[model samples]
Target: MLLNQFLVLGAALFAFGVYGLLVRRNVVLILLSVELMLNAVNINLIAFESYLVSAQAVGQVFAIFVITVAAAEVGIGLAIVLMIFRNRKSANVDDLSLMRW
Candidate 1:
């Protein structure tokens, strides 16, 4: 209901996302964690727009932009992960060192 509540929820989501990103080795789970973080950002943006900002739609527009970017990110991220899986026969991030050579 309140802006602070939304902010707390967003923070919690972001924290979980970060923890998942750091702990998970699978590319797919990492991508999902990234999506979680992005959603948290979107929540914060909308909350701020609704509570702090003026009547302008700037926050909503930014939120939309974030959503668009997140969608593209998921598409490209999944494609890259799929290719990696196909070539490496594994989806583990630790196995991604082949690109360094």
Candidate 2:
């Protein structure tokens, strides 16, 4: 209910996302972790927007932008991942070396 509670929940979600991003080796899982981080940011934005009671709803607007960007990112990311998986037959991040000469 309180602002601090929302903030703490957001922080916790962000922390978990960071941990997953660092520890996961699968590309899909990495993408999911990124989504989690973005969701955490959204939660924080909404919480602040509600707490501030602003007329412009700036935080919510920014959150919407973030969501839009995240969606685009997921689309592009999955496309790349799908291509890589088709070529290599695995979705593990450690297996990707297409950037190297």
Clash pairs detected, candidate 2: none
lDDT of 2 by residue, 20-55 (tens): 999999999999999999999999999999999789
- The window of 10 residues in a row where model 1 has the poorest summed lDDT is 50-59
Summarize candidate 1's per-residue lDDT along 16-101 as a digit string, tens digits: 99999999999999999999999999999999999977677899999999999999999999999999889889999898886686
Model 2 segments more than 4 A misplaced: 98-101
Q: How close is every model to the real structure, measured as TM-score?
A: 0.92, 0.92
**TM-score of candidate 2 versus the correct structure, residues matched by position:** 0.92
lDDT of each: 0.95, 0.96
Worst ten in a row by lDDT for model 2: 92-101
Q: How close is candidate 1 to the true structure, as a TM-score?
A: 0.92
Please list the residue runs of candidate 1 whose C-alpha ends up more than 4 Å from where it truly belongs after superposition. 99-101
